[model samples]
Target: MTTKLPTLPSLQIPFNQPFATGKEFDYIRQAISNGHLSGNGAFTKKCQAWLEAEIGCHKALITHSCTAALEMAALLADIQPGDEIIMPSYTFVSTANAFVLRGGIPVFVDIRPDTFNLDESQIEAAITPKTKAIVPVHYAGVGCEMERIMEIAENYNLFVIEDAAQGVMSTYNSRPLGSIGHLGAVSFHETKNVISGEGGALLINQPDLMERAEIIWEKGTNRSQFFRGQIDKYTWVDVGSSYLPSEINAAFLWAQLEAAETITRKRLALWKQYHQGLIELEKQGKIRCPIIPQHCHHNAHMYYIILPDLESRTTLIKKLKTNNINSVFHYVPLHSSPAGQKYGRVSGNLTVTDDLSSRLLRLPMYPSLMSEQIELIMNTISQFLSSQ
Candidate 1:
């Protein structure tokens, strides 16, 4: 007699589902009717103005992606070859790749185990004469200790370029995450809270950089000034690239931006459900939940948990796969990657980054993620941990 093997469940929950606000299609139609589908059109200007007002930044320029914004920041910062930029290792490749493209060296630091942000305490020790800037990544939409980070930058005469890719609606001490730094980059990737399929913005807090930033966003030309009647014609004034997103993307993003608060609330509610449901597992020492400090007003960009070890995380992922629930692990610490070895150097031991990268797992999170889905995910995780 042959015993039948258990069949895997059909995929029921995906890792993320891009949300659509009601006005997106309407805005796109309007943009098309206006006959300007190129970058820096009416919709793009509206999006830029909205971001500047919302974030209270000196200026905001829409970019093709968060990577483009970071690259623009690198150019605006005037990073030179051999110049060092301090940042945590437990961040996306774009965080390092931007500066690396400018021939700047990335000095990696360890992260805080609680917040998974750059450890503010370790920044000073990494500074040297060649240090040009400090890029603090706000992991999981939780703000970094910007107050301390900014203070350090001031004393060292270093620029603060905030990698606020995951922190669109997040805040630190009531100040917007991207608005505090000299330059901040926000993402509108499909997975982000306010998405336009693939878009980003550069929040320029320093008034001095505003004009140059616009030039850089327009591919090294002073066309923005020319359009504003500040110049008769535009010409390449400095090094830059085609960082701007087209009007279609801007129109879609405008819809999301208009309903930002509602989307954030829905995501937060789902995050809370996951948090409350898994509290017992956290209490039982089976897993660890995300920690948001009192000062941070997070945007609920993601909800993640820390398993006991890599083996445990792997097992849980397998279990979730069998149950048709999609969960995922985050970045491989940039400091440990091949490019990092060639373009960057670790200033201190990335103990927390190394450990967390192996143990952490992100659950499905998006504005469209239903409460029932979250409950199912939590229940599946609880069962897996209980069996372990």
Candidate 2:
């Protein structure tokens, strides 16, 4: 599905605008001419092959959305009714819901105060007899401490599934974000750095799981192998769902992938502009800019500022809206939500998660965003802080 363009004055400065490469429409029209609008078509194969080459994964399967990819990961991980999945509470609901759908209990953990990522130090203590996997979400395209997280998972013989919905073209320790884990999920939703309106990919690193991953992606059928002449017929062979996206979505995404490097470069330039503009406010202790670790490289998926308190954040958002600038807050602590209380349990004190989530406010971030708009945003923030 395509995103609707801005209509109102306030929408002119929207929180997000779906980007497009010059070839998107051309490729989509080609997909129509190819006479195959179903999943796993030529366009879909090109997109998957691009992901495998770019991310350096053993296999890549395109799915309907990131949530679907995570669900497929859960199925491949063999999550049981009482298995426990450890993850940070400061994440999208799909991270937990994927496992929960398999009857796995989510073990909610706190995040690091700096990167807002799952703290590796806290992970070891959270392991138990039922612990099945460690799911580390790369918040804001910044890599988590994957080296340590991988060490912990290896020692415990547990699976590592990366929830890298915001981490395409981002790396940790010179390795791609999603490719570091046993199985990884990436989003191509409208809000992410690379978008297909509604699409995602499951990246397989373990050779053992590569074949099964394709089966799950094809609704538990061996259709992929059958087409390759590895088998004569295909039929349902496992517990899975229809996770693959349409050929149209894959066509649009292929255009984006061809220009992924250019897109990331533009985004990084915009991120630097935001960082430079907010330096004075940050130095004055009025706000906190996002922190990127020296060992990691991010795709500049988003840019946000942390206020001193929730009240300050609310006030700033209101002020921005008054000036036709749209600002928004991020996730609520999952442990505090009703669904979380019913289906998950806390691993430890979530002091950092609660504190950071409340004060964080996301600013306008998109490739097409103008420098003048950023200047106005920074000036408005400085003026508001000064008046206080």
Candidate 3:
């Protein structure tokens, strides 16, 4: 007798899918009709205004990408050559690259195993006279310990620049993720919760940085003030670059911002379903689900599970892919990368960062991911672990 292999599902599911709120086309058409397709146009202003109102930032400037926003923040922070910026190794390269572009060095620290955020306890020891800032990336839309980070910054006279790329509509201790730091950057990339295909915004909390922030956003010119009638003419006044996105992207973003609440509610529901379904597996020590602190209200940007080791994670990922479900892994520790070795220094032991980066696997997460799809994914995961 021949053994029959388990049949795979014909339906395919990707790790992420860009969702539309149905108003994108109408807004884009309006932008086209307005005849001002340039940056800082009507649509751009609407997006910025909405960000300021909703996130309670003193000033908000939309940029072409989160990388652009972080670069702008680096400029505003006045990063000097050899200046060290403290951050986690378990983050996208942009978190360190922005500062490196300004001749700054990234000081890598360990992460809290719970939230996968910069461990606040390790921060003070990493501080040196050359330390210019502390960048707390809100990984997976979960906030870092901002209060303690802020207190440490105040004591050390360091800047706090938040890389809240996955933090749209998320909150930490009742404050919006991007609004608590001296400067914050949020992304609207296709992979993020709210997206404009390729878009981001810089939130300026301190009133003092707003002027220079605009100057940098406008390619080192006072063009914004000139348009506001605050200056006779615009001219290059400082170091900056072309960071603004065109009005078309902003138009699409405006629609997403309007429906941010509804989108978040649905995504949260899906996140809860995954969490509740995987409880038994987590308890059995077969996998570890994402941990959300009591103070955090995450935007459900991602749903990831930690396997026992790298081999198990790789095996499970292959199994899922064979079944037409695409699961993926998150960042490699920046400290272990080639560029990171060249441009950054390690502050403390990165045991957690290394272990988590290897074992973590992100499942399918998107607003339109049907409940049935979630069930299939969970059951597949459960069965695979059971056989292991």
Candidate 4:
């Protein structure tokens, strides 16, 4: 008898779901018909105002991408050649890339095993005479130890740049992630909770820094004032780049912001479901779910499972693929990556990062993911673990 194996299922579960189209089109069209399709138009202003009011940001500048927003942060902070920035190794390449682009040394530090964020305890030890800023990335939408990090930054007179790209609406001690530092950056890439296709925002927390923030957002020009009629004409005041995103993208994001509470409730429910459902597997020493701290509320951005080792994690991913599930690993420690080697310094061992990256696998988690899909994914994992 000939037996046939089933084909691997297309992730039908994409890494992210872009915005809902109908409302988005209406909003975008409203911006266009209102006679402005350029940057900082009506839609852009609405988005910015909402972010400032709701997200606890003093002001927000919608940009082309989070990467651009981060780069602007580096520039505004005056990150110069030979300056060092402290950040966790278990982060998106952009976190380090932004600083490095401004000729800043990326001082890599290990992450907490549980939170997968920068180990605040290790940050002070990594600081040097030239250390300029400390960038704390709130990994997986869980807030980092901001209090301790801020204390350290204050003591050393180092600037704090919160990479709150995933921490939108997620808070630390009741204060929003982006609003906690001197400056912060948020992402609206298709992969993030919010959507503008390819967009982001820079959040200025320091009241004194808002003017410079706006100037840099307008490509180092005083155009923001000109647009406000505060000036008759605008010209380059200092070095800057084109960071503002078009009104269309900002309109799309406005829809998401309006539905933020709804979307967050659903995602948080799904996150709890995953936790409760996977707890059995965790107890069996098969997988580990996220460790949510008492003081924090997470945004359900990423749901990861840490297998016992590299081999088990790889095997699980392969098994999930065969069963029509798409699971992926993240961030091989940057220090070991080719680019990290070229520009950064790895002070101590990244044993935790090395271990976790190999062992961690992110599952299908989104508002659209069905209950049936969840059960099927878990059943497949159970079957695979039983076999092992």
Candidate 5:
């Protein structure tokens, strides 16, 4: 009798996986067949309408990327040199970079360990006369303390720009995440639940800001009105950049948006599976998992686990690689990063951020992550820890 070998599992599991429903092909076909490849085309309008209707945002302008959308927000806020914008340090660099580009000072704040979001309690102490805005990033698709943050903003007479990059369709107390702030930015990068290669949207919540927001998005030109026939000819009106995404990208995103509910449902199911499957290990002190706050209805954008320490985390990652499971980690605190050191000013010691970065690991998550695969992943992690 010949001895049998165990089946090989793929070593590298991608951190984020996008799902393409059937509607993507249909929209791509329609977009190509229609021959309008410019920005602000029919599909763009459709996408805008769908988002406006679904997200409850006053208006949603598709942009080239989340970074662009953030830039637009800073511009709309009239962020001048030395204007301080407060945000948590544990976030994508773009959260601070946007404000930095507009000559705004970024005040890096520490995050609450449990939620991995800006510590609302720590915010009031950081405000000074130069503080112009408060950027509350919705980390890992989890909601921040929006109501509390807003109250502080109102009291301090500050602008609130929500970085909803990972929180699309995720809500807080039945209200959408982006709409709660004056302006918000969302991402549709390939790593997101819905993708259009590289794309984003700027959410305009204040009706008064709509006209200016549109202008800034069109590179400070009145091109949007020109396309809408409200103006005979578009001209350079203000300072801006090419923030609009192409029609093809909009069309591709439209496909995903059309099937948004379905995609969300599938991903949520997988998220729960991982949560339940890994509960035992977490309870046994092997690792820790995410905990959704009371008000948040998260989109399951990522599923991360915190190991005992850096050495154990490294050991587990290596074991997973040996098993061909491509798990990963992300975002060292920006305040400590080289670029952040040059521009933004750090506030306090980032103890929580430093601790979390060393222990956290993002597991493979996608709409197609089947139940059996989740079991395999959980078992492999468990086996690796037990072996130690």
Candidate 6:
């Protein structure tokens, strides 16, 4: 008798898929009819105004990308050569690169083992005279301990720039994630919950910084004030860049922004299902699910699990692939990367960051993901763990 192997299922699940709100085309057509495809046009103002009102920021400037927003932040914070910025090593390179562009030093800190956020406790010890800012990345749309971070910033007179790239529609202590810090940056990449293909926004919380932020968005010119009749003519009064996004991108973003609530609600529902389905595995020590603190109301931007070790994580990922599930891992620790080693210095041990980087695996997460797909993913994971 010949031994037989069970055929794998044909279902294919990708790591991420961009969600459409059904009005992107309509808005884009409207923008085209308006005859202003340039940056900071009518559609741009509409998006900016919506963000300012919704997030309660003093001013909001839409940018071409999150990287642009962070770079603008570095300029607004007046980051100079040799200045130091403290942030977790577990974040995307942009978190450090923005400040590095200004000749600033990145002081890499460890992350919290549970939330995978910058360790708030270690931030104070990392602070030095050269420390100019603290860039706390709100990983997976889960807010960091902003109150403590804010208190530390107040004590040291350091600027706090919330890297809220994944924190849109998420809140901390009843306040929006981006609005709590001195400045905040949000992403609209295709992978994010709300997307504009490649878009971002700079949220200026401090009233003093709003004027300059606008100037910086307009490429170092006071063109905004000139348009508002606040100046005789816009001129090169300060250093700035063309950080604004095209009206087309803003128009597409408007549709997503308007439907943000409904999309978030549906994603949250899927997140809950995954949590419920995997609770047994988490309890049995097979995997560890994401943790949300009592004060946090995450936007369900991602759903990830931490395996027991790197080898186990790799094995599980392979198993899922064999079953046609496209699971993926996240960032390598910045402190351990080549550029990070060259441009940044580690303040303390990054044990958690390194460990989590190897162990964490993000599952399929998107608003458009079907309920049947969610069930298939959960069942496949459960079966794999059970066999282990």
- TM-scores across all candidates? 0.97, 0.98, 0.97, 0.96, 0.95, 0.96
lDDT of 5: 0.86
What C-alpha lDDT values do all the predictions have?
A: 0.91, 0.93, 0.93, 0.86, 0.86, 0.92
- Two-way TM-score contest, 1 vs 2, winner: 2
TM-score of 5: 0.95
lDDT (10s digit) by residue, model 5, range 1-388: 1111122244345445556665666777888889888788898889888878878989999998999999999999999999999999899999998999989889998888987999888899889999999999998889999999999999999999999999888998888879899898999987787778899999999999999999988889988798789989999999998888888899889978876777778889988999998899888988999989888999988889999899998888888777767788878888888888888887766788889988999898877666887888889998988887
Pairs of residues at least 3 apart in sequence or in different chains that clash in candidate 3: none
| Worst window of 10 by summed lDDT in candidate 3 | 1-10
lDDT of 4 by residue, 26-141 (tens): 88888888887779888888889988998788889999999999999999899999999999888889999999998999999999988999999999889999999999999988
Whose TM-score is greatest here? 2
- Candidate 6, pairs of clashing residues: none
Q: What are the per-residue Cα lDDT tens digits for candidate 1 across 75-104?
A: 999999999999999999999999999899
- How big is the positional error of residue 60 in model 1, measured in Å on the Cα after superposition? 0.2
The candidate with the higher lDDT, 3 or 6, is: 3
Report the lDDT of model 2 for residue 103.
Answer: 99
- Compared to the true structure, candidate 6 yields what TM-score? 0.96
lDDT for each residue of candidate 2 in 1-388, tens digit (9 for 90 to 100): 3333454454658888778877888999999999999999999999999999999999999999999999999999999999999999999999999999999999999999999999999998899999999999999999999999999999999999999999999999899999999999999998999889999999999999998988888888899899999999999998778898999999999989988998899899999999998988899999999999999899999999999999999999999988888999999989999999999999979999999999999999988888998888888989999988
Off by over 4 Å in 1: 1-10
**TM-score attained by model 1:** 0.97
lDDT of 6 by residue, 1-388 (tens): 1111222245477777777777888889988999999998888988999999989999999999999999999999999999999999999999999999999999999999889999999999999999999999999999999999999999999999999999999999989989999999999998899999999999999999998898888989999899899888778978888898988899989988988898899899999999998899999999999999999999999999998899988988899888788899999888889999999999979888888899999999987677899999989888878887
